[model samples]
Target: MDLESHRFISYFLPDQRPELCHSATIEKFPPGTVIFEENEKPDALYLVLDGKIEFSKRGGLGQYQNVAWAEENDFFGEFGVLDGQPRSARAVTCTSATIAKIPRDRLMDILERSPGKVVLQLFHHIIHYLRLTTEQYVNQMVHKHKMMAVGEMANTIIHDLKSPFTGISLANSMLKDLHQDEETQEWCNLIQAQITQMVVMTEEILEFTRGKATLNQKTFNLGESLEKFQRLNFIYWNQHNINFILRCDNIILNGDENKLMRVWQNLVGNAVEALDEQGGQIVLIAAKLGQDALIKISDSGPGIPEAIQSRLFDPFVTYGKRGGTGLGTAIALSIVEAHGGDITFESQAGKGTTFYIRLPLC
Candidate 1:
């Protein structure tokens, strides 16, 4: 082999036998060729002699994202070889490339024969790679935790500020109605309603942040509560041109009325927002399924993307034009879990989505 093509030998001891290097072979690949794929065995070490290689993985929703790249003289597959594990990523050639392949057995033989220099070099490389990987992981975790803490703090501050805001907005609406003409009063009413809605939304978010929102264990008529929730929010839904459908016989569930009210509110509110100005249908159904009470909510708006459906209940994951705070479903999940119930959903892009809630009956 040419001295330049045998550059990997520099990592070995000066007195090491040259037989190991002589056993290696140089191979060439064309652009778009897959050098290795994730989960494949790493039986040989590949040292790039020329051109570029891209490392990527299949992400959520079956998408591929390039996470790293390698260039001339860079070594690939070393990490898999040292750890005795399958390949962690897929590598593809970005351009026509030349690579030197060293068989694992031959490499091990050279390392065993030249203990000091080979061990020292291997140790240095392994330690450096591990340190970098650990740092990257830690940084990501820290950033996530920080964002959660900030969201919690904001929820608390907003809660405290909303009470006075609600009172002021209400009083302003009354005052404007008494002192202004019909047109001005109408605009004032719109502003007041918006402020009040904001106040209610803030309180709901605060309840979610505290992680204490749950149905109170009390015997309440599920049918009646559903009716009240619909009646209260009917104007809002109607104004948005969202058709609401309720199909449930008088069924009773032992739960908190206020907390369950919030659950329906959030789910229905989400459905309404998803409908956009194009108009869509929201269906709410309650039925007896085995020994549990089943509540199903479905909507006709564009459905949740597959990329985010798995993480939909996770805090800070949102979809739609409203750019949600990502707490609604998280709070809904927490509340349902607290009630000894469970929630699930099925969705397809451009079609629609449906959420199912199952709770044990008292």
Candidate 2:
């Protein structure tokens, strides 16, 4: 056994059974070799003995971004081992590397019989991981709050100035029309439309700050809600050449009708925008699952990238699209969760995306 390999084990499995340490085998990989891909089943934990490893994911636009890097003495793959879940990121060798592959079953066995050392080590790793994660989360939250605060402040200013802005826009339109200049009229009309959009967005920001603009819960037919939502938003969908389909029936639920309306509105609006004039199909389905109601909205647009899925519900993490505030889905999720419900989504590149909402039946 290499001294470096032993040192790696000592860092994690110190005071463990010697036999368990001997059970781990040193594996080597060359640069560009994929150690594992995201979502692969849990197998063995890899402790890097030497060289470097890169953790990356495919971006929403079909590009790869390196999110993390691991070097000698560092470990990767513990998350999958501990959670019994698939890998969340792709790991590839950045150079010639030697790694100790610690079998998951053996690790579990040791953890069950001699939990103290294992638990201690696991706890230490978790604490360190969580510390870093929490720091990043706190920083992101602070940044988001700052952005929201600025947005709110700007919204307030806009609200205060809206009357004058509207008056000026109307005056410009009248002047352009009276001058009989098509170019000037078009420019004025565009400016007025943009100002109008800004006004609407400012109102939404104010509403989001108050947290009082969500749906008011009531017992209503889910099918009816879908129909009404579709009818109300059909023109927007049609203008964009998008197809809307409803596959739900007479499923009823106790939820805020207006809030659910917003939910559908936001989701559908997102899907349409994601399609970006290429046009696609949007499907809404509702069904009852025992004591819960299940609603799914699927889109034939480019699916959300795996990189952003974990933080997709977080506020203001946009993909840099036009008119995207990145708060719609976040607000939608908060509303659903408040109603004793949960929301989840699935997406894949080039295929499509689907959002699932599960709520307890009233």
Instruction: List lDDT for all candidates, in order.
Output: 0.77, 0.77
Off by over 4 Å in 1: 1-204, 207-215
Q: Write candidate 1's Cα lDDT for 1-362 as tens digits.
A: 34344445677765553675576788899999999898898888888888899887777888766666767867778877767799988999999988888888777766667767677876787677567656655665664575567558767768687778877887886889587788777667656655645655555566665555534489988888788667667778879898899988668888866666667877877777778878889999999888899999999989988898888998777787576667778777877888889999988877888999998887
Q: What is the Å distance of residue 219 in model 1 from its true position?
A: 1.5
lDDT digits (tens) for residues 1-362 of candidate 2: 36344544564445564756676888889999999998899899888888999887777997766667778877788888888998988999999998888899987776677647657866787688657755655675576576678567857787698788878887987888787778776566656654655555455556666664544567998887677667666767899999999988568789777666667777878889989888989998888888998989999988888888899988776542588768888778877887889999999888888999998887
Give the per-residue Cα lDDT of candidate 1 at 326: 70
Q: Which stretches of candidate 2 lie over 4 Å from their true place?
A: 1-141, 150-215
Candidate 2 lDDT score at position 299: 91
Q: After superposition, how far is residue 166 of candidate 1 from its true place, in Å?
A: 7.8
**TM-scores for candidates 1 onward, in order:** 0.54, 0.51
**Model 1 alpha-carbon miss at residue 206, Å:** 3.6
